[model samples]
Target: MIAIDNVLISDEVVEEQFVCDLTKCKGGCCEDGDAGAPLLKQELDHLNNYYEVIKPYMTPQGIRENEKQGRYVYDRHFGWVTPTIEGQICTYAFRDAQNVIKCGIEQAYLDGKLPWKKPISCHMFPIKMSQSEVDPSMEYLNYEPREDLCSAACKLGKKLKVPAYVFLKDAIIRHYGEEFYATLDATAQHLKEQKG
Candidate 1:
């Protein structure tokens, strides 16, 4: 693992390549999971603040579910998560013109209706975080390309020479900070040189 600031990043992120192929996957990441998108502690407030604006953009089923279960729900496995539509799509999700599921919260943000974009977890596709074993407070970020759904992204990223960490630069910066991302980039460059 590459220790960057307080986060321990897995080699998969440094070595592996990935770029979300939304056309092929149809935003399956928003719905394929057993639970809704993982929510951070502060995101509860974002949900609360943005629910009103995000609601209009959501589907009927999504709205009903959110109204019934609340914007965020407590899950036995995932702790706090965005409420799901019958254990399927996120309550903040809606089908686009292409019939692909998209985040209503993101749409609202795109329209300049909300300050928050979406969950950091959702923003950081293929990069999932978990509590470190040594220190539960510390997070271990790993690149995990979902089979079938992300196969195209893996191919494209490999073809384009975009490593997972580089592809997820913005989201990582949003989570960590610009300085931390810079340090990570330097580390990745060093690793690449060593490999060469």
Candidate 2:
């Protein structure tokens, strides 16, 4: 494990390889999970604030689901999560020309309609962070290797020699800041040397 700033990072982040193969997975992560996309407090606020623009890009069913669930929903099992269409695909997701699920929130951000990118949690694929049991102010950054959706990604990343922390640099930086990510990079290099 690596400790930087207030985050405790798992070594698997440096050891594991992963790169999302969207073509094969077809954004399965957006649809396969039992629950909707998890949301932070600020994300819930942003969803409400940006609903006017975001609504146009969303599917009719997605819009209706959002209306029925009220932007976001709180569940005992999942805590606060983005509303889903009958608890299937995330309400913020839409199909592209290839019929692959895509995030409407991210599309809006890419189009310069919204200032923030999609949720940090969404951006940081395969990495889940939780408050540290030792210290609540700090966080535990762990690698969670999901099957089906991420297996191809893992193989692809291994073929290309990209580690999880390196593959997810931008998202890690976004969530934890540049200094934290720099430490992760350093940790990766050290691990590589140790293996050699």
Candidate 3:
């Protein structure tokens, strides 16, 4: 584990490579899960605040689900999460012309309708965040790529030589800070040198 401040990052974040192969995976992360994408407490407010703006980007089914289930839902196992469509695909996801599921919230953000992107949890996929079991105050960032859904991404990451941390640079910076990401990059370099 790599420790920087209160966060403990798993070594796999740097040791193992991963880049989302969306064309191959078809954005299964947005659909395969039993529950919808996880949401932070503040993100619920963002959804409520920007629902009108994001509505246009969402599919008819997603909008209907949102209307029926509210902006988000509480999961006993997962805390807060976006509601799912028929308990399958996320309510914030829409299928593109290619039939690939994509995040409507992020699409809205990219279009500048909202200042923030999707929920941090969704943004930092393959890297799950949880409170440390041993130390509640500390947060743990575990590199946990789903084998079933991420095989293509893993193969592509190996081919491209992109570490998971590097692949998630923007999201990491958004969640932590530029300085923290810099520290992680430097640490990854040091680890690489030691291995060499």
RMSD of 3: 1.0
User: Could you tell me how far off, in angstroms, the CA of residue 93 lies in candidate 1 after the best superposition?
Assistant: 0.7
Tens digits of per-residue lDDT, candidate 3, 23-141, equal 99999998887688888888989999999999999889999988898999999888899999898999888888888888989999999989989999888989999986788899999
Score every model by TM-score: 0.96, 0.95, 0.97
Predicted model with the maximum lDDT: 3
Query: Residues 95-114, candidate 1, lDDT per residue (tens digit)?
Result: 88898888999999999999
**Poorest lDDT segment (10 consecutive residues) of candidate 3:** 31-40
| Stretch of 10 with least lDDT, candidate 2 | 127-136
C-alpha-based local distance difference test score of model 1? 0.88
Segments of candidate 2 deviating more than 4 angstroms: none
lDDT of each: 0.88, 0.85, 0.92
RMSD of each: 1.1, 1.2, 1.0
Better of 1 and 2 by TM-score: 1
- What are the per-model numbers of colliding residue pairs? 0, 0, 0
